[model samples]
Target: MASLLYRLGRLSFRRRRYFALLWVVLLGACAFAAVNAPEAEDEGFTVPGTESQRAFDLLDERFPGGNSEGADARIVFAAPDGRKVTAGDTRAAVERVVDEVGAGSQVREALSPFEDDAVSEDGSTAYSTVTYDAPGEKLTEDTKKALMDAVEDGRDAGMTVEVGGSAVDAGPEFGGVTELIGIGVAALVLFLTFRALVAAGLPLVTALVGLGAGICAIMALGLPTTTITLALMLGLAVGIDYALFIVSRYRAERAEGHPAEEAVGRAVGTAGSAVVFAGATVVIALAGLSVAGVPMLTEMGLAAAGTVVIGVLVALTLLPALLGFFPQAVLPRAHRAARQPTAAAKEAAGANETTGAKETTGAKETTGAKEAAGSRWARFVIRRPLASLLLSVVGLGVVAVPALDLQLSLPGDEAQPTSTTQRRAYDALADGFGPGFNGPLTVAIDAKKADDPKAAVAQATKTLKATDGVVDVSPPLFNKAGDTAMVSAVPSTGPSATATKNLVKTLRAEADRVEADAGASMLVTSQTAMNIDVSNKVTAALVPYLAVVVGLAVLLLMIVFRSVLVPLKAALGFLLSVAAAFGVIVAVFQWGWLADLLGVAQTGPVMSMMPIFLIGVVFGLAMDYEVFLVTRIREAYVHGERPAQAVVTGFRHSARVVVAAAVIMIAVFAGFIGMTDSMIKMMGLGLAAAVFFDAFIVRMTLVPAVLALLGRTAWWLPRWLGKVLPDVDVEGEKLTRRLGADPGPPARTTPREESVNA
Candidate 1:
């Protein structure tokens, strides 16, 4: 890597513009390719007999001709006063909504109380039982704009019309807003950090290249995937991350008097390896979500992994090409006075460590230049390892106190953009109708083989009405082919609360009891049932996912560092971070701290599987920066430095880079909270906080201090085990240092390094 850096440096001195042009050509080609990218239609949500063949099979077997017991969307008409809206004004509004409902362009169908006897009796408000023609078809930008305009037009009409249903409430605008926030935040962070337009542009460029290439690749990869709101942000983040490491390295090389090309090569050789590993870590972490037992989550994992793969390749190739192209931009501005080393500078570089304040790196020549000037961090971590760890533990513990209060509700159109017609109708429904104004659980009792599905449904209806909060139940919506009857179960509370949980419990248990007494098999299934099953699936898979993540992290660390103790300590440290994140999630979301600040409905219960999900992802991210830091420390240790020296010194050099990268990510994540959807908001805040606290407080502070306390023991291994493991070059430093020391080589000097006549 060092040799590569030096050679590239030489090339930068010779062919700076050529390198720049090469990158320009390549970047243009990549972008052009992306613009012409083909679309891939993957299985997301499938309609019974549309393009998704599998969906048809499932529908035919499980829910043919619509499962009456399945969930349905509700649309309502309302007055502004928040009461039973039944004026001529409300009637006109209701008619307008109905007009849209039967349009077929907006959805599969919207069946309201006027259309279905199951909706409501003596209703001032109507329900729109909607189904979409294409569940996975993204609303195009123009369509979303038109929806927004139509809603404004309705308001102008002064009829007080609001339209919402299952498939209409949550539309594409929410997704777009979320993406915009992420991009804006990331852009702001990079601009602030870089301070120059070019420098700022560089990271964004890398992000665009990586994301564009990844999108095209995903389209071409023959995977069952479609574009999502989160896709662009995820791609940009990973891309910027990859670029940051290389750019930081380039800057470090410029400090060493190496040219841009050399820095690129060196950066690729060292930071490139770390980027690959970091990308892999992310892949591993997200892969755990594949086992979330939802086809959506499984698809998410695959798409996320595929994006990372594309990012890694573009980052490796295009970045180096860009570096070769823009030597002047890559290097810092030069000045005549700044050209010479100070008289005392040479003395500082050659000095050895002595009885001093604290030791960082044993490589005095390299280490002294990199330390954080006046770092209070070192004093705190080194002097009080246990205390630092405890502070992080307690702080995060307090934050997670809300995890016990977390809740997971199925994302719906009501969570969509407030500006859209669908979302407006949903709001209208909720205002005039009730909490289940959008979509309520429909419990179907399977009496398909029974002589009397009507009696069984009546029994199920009685059981549902007996439940404390169930507002009403349908008598029976009998299927022609099967002796099955569907019954609606509406609750007073929203779908992601303790009330929802209680409702599910009551419906299943009471209906089962009624069926047993009636000598019938009652299958209670609905939207609520699907949600219940999904939550249960997440719960079931949590343990295995966590085990895989932790075990793999430890093993990877062990291989990378060649010491069990080092990896063991690293794993424990990461575990601490995960626990801390969990505790905070519980405390804030479950317990409801500043939920208003977070913009959630309320803390429900930690999402049934949030802990497991957060653990895998945050652990891998924590470990990535950890490796980026510790591997350098290991390099110092391998070169005869003490473990304490390695930890402190390595941290001193890498801390700023890692922190800068982390700050950018935090910004990107935190911005997500600004989105309208409550679920996305929760996820945004939770992940943002986890990364911020973990990266800065836990990984940066607790990790270094603890390792310092352990001293040489942190790197200890049995002699026999050590003998079996071959030494791998951490930075190719041995050969570089040897070349520096060898008397056989000619003495090195450059035009910039020549001594004056004085």
Candidate 2:
């Protein structure tokens, strides 16, 4: 691993011009491809063999002409003075807009609210439903342009016009304000951490280059539906952090008196290796989403994983090559000349040669020169390992309490922010009809086996109406063939409410009873039902997915560190941090503790996909800090320092770097908290909180205490296991040997080093 990074570093420096030009041309090619990329299709995710899917299949088979593929668009209109919708003047305005929309292209059917009894009882609000000929996502750009023009006509009239529905509300906008905000935060963090303008800009420049290529590749592949915003979010976070890690190391090496080329090589050989491992862990965890057997999740995970792969490659190759281009700009001027002798300093050195020699000897004997500011704190924690352990546990425990009450469900219209027109349309429909009006369930019945198909339809309708949760049951509509009938039922509860979920289950149970009594096939299907089905499948699959990720991570860590306890400790701490993140999310979003402040609405259950995503992303990120911190500690341990002193020294050196990298990630993720979409906001905040806890509490505090408490046992592994496990040399110890600076033998029985203790 170290040899590969070292070779890459040497190659980058050797052919720096070619490397720079290669990246520039690649970026240009990707940009050109992005401009000419084909439009992506949105084929929504579904869990096969679920009841809702079964219902959809039956409907498609039995009723070929039914409105299954297309979605209805709702045009909401209101008078500026709040005049009654039925007023002659308001009616004329709304009718004109409705006429314009109906006359527009792609309209399969247009039902005026006035003629269709869709007006509110107070007559202040009315809407028109327009059904398109094709699926909402399949609408051509020309059709969208025409629709927007018709919408403009309504707005031009003396009315407040808003449109909502699948055709009009194409999810959330991606990579505009949110993307910029994230980049701004990342740039700020980098500048503050590096304290050099040019040094800070390097990571951002490389990261953006990598991000552009990643996004362009995604666009070119035309799998935009699976991962649009998410891919961008991760690409930015990982790319910046990956470069930051390598740059920090490179600067550190330069500060320690290494030449520019040598520093870059060692940095690449060491930190670059860690980046490779960390990035691979992330990619593996993300790609593990395939275990869920959902196409959308699979594609999204793979897409995001692809970006991380690019980030790793960019960090290893492009970053080194770029650094080589302006080696003087990689660090501060003061740092670059720290080891050089000036004229006056050289004369003073000659006069005080004996004094200078003694001072140098004292500095070599003392550890204070090498100790970081955080080392004192780390040493203090080591002294009171038990107390530190208890405190860290209690702190993480408090944050994890809310996770016990974690509920899994996909947010429906209720989850949409109130600012959106789709949400307003949802609220209008709920206000006029009922909450359930926005989430009607379709009951499909195959009654060809029944003695009397018409009678079976009547019986099922009666049964549904009699159900406790059913607020209204539409009259059964049969296919032209008379073999299939469908009924639409409005529940008494809103879609995301607990009562609505119960209602779904209740109706399914009753439908079974009806099917048994009438000898007909019956299935319940709806947008809400499909979401519930997906939520349930995701929830069920989460455990296995986690098991796979955790198992693989543990195995990988064990091999890398050659320690059984170390990996277990890391895995456990990571899980705790992840739980705390979820707990914070549940308290903030689900419990509505600070939903107003955070701009989160539609709070009921956390998004079903959130836990799955959090596990993969958060776990991978936690492993990043784990690898960074633990590998340093292991390096010290292999060099024969006592466990406690080794931890203090390792923590002292790696603490700031780990914390800085984590802050960059937190900034990148937290910047998206301002997003309008509740799901994206959740993801942003959840990831930020998870990284924070993992870096600050788990890595900084708990890990050191545990290692101190365990002593040498922390590095223990069975002889058989150690021999079988492949040596994943992340520390570049082999490179040290080749550099002729290898420390001979482990100080197995040497007295405790006084320098390490202080």
Candidate 3:
């Protein structure tokens, strides 16, 4: 591996045009792929569990559920004070508002206190319900505003009004604000780190290609588009980032007077290994998410894994190819005199030593980066591996303590960003009536003669009382003279999922007892109950799902690295990083540390699916750094250097590039915390934790520290294992040796002993 990086690096110095032409070809292919990317079906999303979804066509007719599709919007009318109202003017004014809102005829059911039979029993405050029958399962803005304006017009008529419901009610306006922040921060860091207009833009170009491909692919696979769309953006960011680090390193070699071919080869040999490792790490980390047992979460895991794999490939191949197309004008002038960076230049190569390594004609030792980076990282970790590791351990421990406190929330359109009228209506009702008003659990009973007169309503009443969440159990009342029984169980407050689960537990238990006692079967189903069942089903399937993914990822890495331990060790590193990241999220967000500072209003437990998503995403991303760093070390080792020397040398060479890459990622992820969207903010915060830990703690300190500690065993493979395993030179060491002039072993750094006198 070491000889290959050295040789290809030398070859790049020897052959420039060949490499440039090759790059042009790859870019053209990716662009063609991008151009051919097909449009998705209706924004290209499919609802999950569609094949096995409960067949409720019968229920629709049976219950006619009188508009039970859930509320479309809620209109709130309040007086300035909280005092109960007996005023006729307040009522009249509210009626006028409701009339105006309902006048558009776009909605099916517009209910309000001002409307007949719709006023609150106390008449202290009022509300309006806006129902709709839309093609895409949501009311249009035209209808939403009519409802909103009715309330607004009432404000002038001595009533204060608010509108909230539907998608608008699901989340806050700043819901995706964190995403914007993360992307912005990432872009800024990319710009600063690369210090070249084209270089900075390179990731964007390849990422867009990969991302467009990912989107098209997933859409073609037929998955629903929801909050999970956030994954796409994140995937693109990481893909671009991974490519930027490698190509920039390669470009630096070119600027240093090496032919583009050798530079490309070296880039692939050292940074290429890193890319492979990062890809493996990502695959392992995300594969775990597949095991989380929730189909929704598993789907997300698959999507993320696919994106990383495909993205990395593009970064490695397409990005290098695109960079080869740059005109000679893009290369910096010879470094005899200082040169100011233009935006274009800055986007390609930051004025850092990462670019300067090329000045040695892509040679190592005197010019080798791994040794320098390794030494610097060793200085930090050797002195304080314990302290740094401990801080990560302790902080993560503190934060993850709340993971035990995590509870799942119900999913809804209202869970999306709330810029729509339905969301506004939902908020109005949640705020005006009660937070629980947004969602509640329903209990449905199935008996022998569901709607017949012979059904025993009294027995069902007794059955419901013993139910755990029998908060306000109602006596069974039959639609057709005591045949079918159904009751509604409204949770006192909060997301409906948990409350539904509890109610299902209580109902199922009582139903079992009744059946055993009376020899009659009954059915109990609720939104919450179904959701709980889904959770259980997902959990049951999580382990096997994870095993398949992890196994595959490990197999791929092992094949690439030709060492079982490398794959296994990388998996372990990814785990710690993810664990630490999760712990921080729990400590800060769930535990409510500086919630105001972060603008996280809800301190309730994170969504049930969040942990798996975060862990997978973080693990995959951190592996990116791991891959680059380890590859350099391995390359040095294959050069016949002793393992100890390899560790030190490899660390020096790979350290700075890894650090710079991580910093850019950290900035991008962290910057998104300030976005207006809550979910986007969560993503930013989680990624920020992952990136910070990967850079300062994992890649810089822990990884090098461990490799130094591991000696040759880090890449050990048994003779028998070697016989069975196919040798894969992800960098083609044999091919490199045969093809190029040797750059020679990197010159050893001047010792501190000799430096003082020099």
Candidate 4:
């Protein structure tokens, strides 16, 4: 790996201009393709074999007129004074909206609620159903613009107008503001860490180039999945992080007195190798999402995994090329001045130098200046490993406590901020009708087997109405063929409410009972039921999915570290960090702790898909710090030092770079909270917390303690296993050996003659 990286660095440096032009042309092409690519569709989460899916299939089969496979929306109208929508003026306004919206070429039909007594009892609100020819998510940009414009026109007529439903809410928006904020924060962190403008800007430039290309690639592929937002988010964060890691290591190597080209090679050979492994771990974790067997998730995982791969490749190749052009300028002015001696200082140093006295004094000063703080931290933790371990555990436990009560559900409009028109429409419908009116359950009754179709319909209605949670059951609407009919049943609770989910299960169970006696088959489905199915599937798959990812991570770590205990410790720390992050999500988004301060409008269950995505993403991300820190410690251990001393020395070398990388990652992820989408916000906060805790608490404190406590056993491996496991030299130890450089503690003191000659 070291030799390969060295060659790569030399090639990149020699062919820097060619590489630069190549990347520019490639990114330009990607941008062009992305501009021409079709907009992504929101393929709602689906488990094909589930009961809700079965019902949906039956409906689409038995009744073709309803456009059951397409999108449905509701245009809600309300008066300012809570006056009845049935009043003359209000009714006229509603009629005009229906007419304008229904006349659009995109709409298949618009059904007025006034004709069907769908208005509220107080007459304060009414809504019309607008069915589009295509699935709402697949609607063209022009069609959406037309629909929104029509809906907006209603406000001019003195009516409160808002549109709700999956279709209306699925329109895509940008996180440009959030992305800019994240970039700014990341820039600040890089500048402070490097204290060099050129050094700080390099990582950001590389990251942006990779991100821009990756996003365009995703768009160009036009994968029949909803992964644009996820791809962009992952691409941006990982791109920045990968570049930061490599660049920081490169700068450190330069400070160690290696020439520009040699520094780049050593940095790429060591830290760049670590970046590849870290990026692969993340990609593997995301790709593991395909095991859940959901098409949407599978595609999303692939899309994100591909973007991460791009980020890694760019960091490895293009960054090296870019760095070669301005190696001298990469270091800060102060750093450069420090490396070169002034004439007066050189003369004074020569006069003071005698025997080896000056050499020994300089070594001590170097150690004191460079190793004081990190060494102190390492020694402090090592001296009281038990106490350190206990404190770290206690801190993580406090943050994880809220996870015990974590509730998972799809984020409905009720959880959305009130600033959105979708939320306003959702609120109006719930107020005028009932909470369940927004997500009514559709019961598809197959009556061909029953002795009497009418008898089956009547029996099913009676059974549903008798169910404890049923709020209202609509009369049966039979298909023209008379072989099937559908019934709409609203639950007593809101769509995302726990009670509503339970109601779905209860009704499905009762339908089985009804079918047994009445010789009929009933399949219940709706947006709410489908959401419950997705949640249930994810819940069932969580433990197994985690087991797969953790096992893979452990195997990879063991190969790299060649230690049983090290991998186990890393995996455990990862779990603790993820749990703490989830706890934060539960407390803020679920328990409403300081939610208002964050601009969250309503507190509810965490998004159903959050845990699955978070576990995969955060676990992979946490490993990044582990790889950086542990590799350095292992490098020291291999070079000859007591286990305890090695831990301190290695940590002192790597802590700064690891922490800076984590801060950059956290900033990029947390920036997503500024997005309009609630799901994105939850994801941002969860990921930021994961990186924060993993870097500060786990890697900084707990890992050192555990390594200290284990002593020599921390590096132990069976002879057979050692021979079987390939050596993953992530720290360029071989290169140091080949170059005949002192890989151990910095030479205690220079030879007397060498010191005097200086």
Candidate 2 residue spans exceeding 4 A from truth: 77-94, 114-126, 134-162, 176-179, 338-370, 741-758
Number of the top-ranking candidate, with TM-score as the measure:
4
By lDDT, the better pick of 2 and 4 is 4
Q: Give the number of the best model, judged by lDDT.
A: 4
Q: Give the local distance difference test score of model 3.
A: 0.57
- Tens digit of per-residue lDDT, candidate 2, span 1-758: 88778778867865778998998998889878878988876556567869998898888888887755676688887666657778887788788777877786788887888898878777767888888988777777887777677777777867767778878766555755755776787788777776677878888888888888888888888885548677777888888888887887777665444556777787898889888888878988999988877777888899999988888888888998888776766565554343453444422322211111111111221244434545666787889999999998899999999999998777766777888777877787777677888888999988999999999988888888898888889888899889789999999888777787888888788877888899787788988898788888888898899899889988988877889999899989988899999999999988998889888876788888888888988888899888888887777667666777777656655676677778888888887788777778888999999999999999898998999899999999999997899886787777767775743222121122122112
lDDT of 1 by residue, 13-75 (tens): 345456556646655675576556565554434222221223234334656656322223444
lDDT of 3 by residue, 126-238 (tens): 67666665422355667655655666687777665766555234322322555566566666766665555666677777776767666656655665455235546456667
In model 4, what is the error at residue 88, expressed in angstroms? 3.3
Model 2 poorest 10 in a row by lDDT? 353-362
Worst 10 residues of 4 by lDDT: 353-362
3 or 4, greater by TM-score: 4
Model 4 stretches astray by more than 4 angstroms = 36-44, 68-71, 79-82, 135-159, 334-372, 741-758
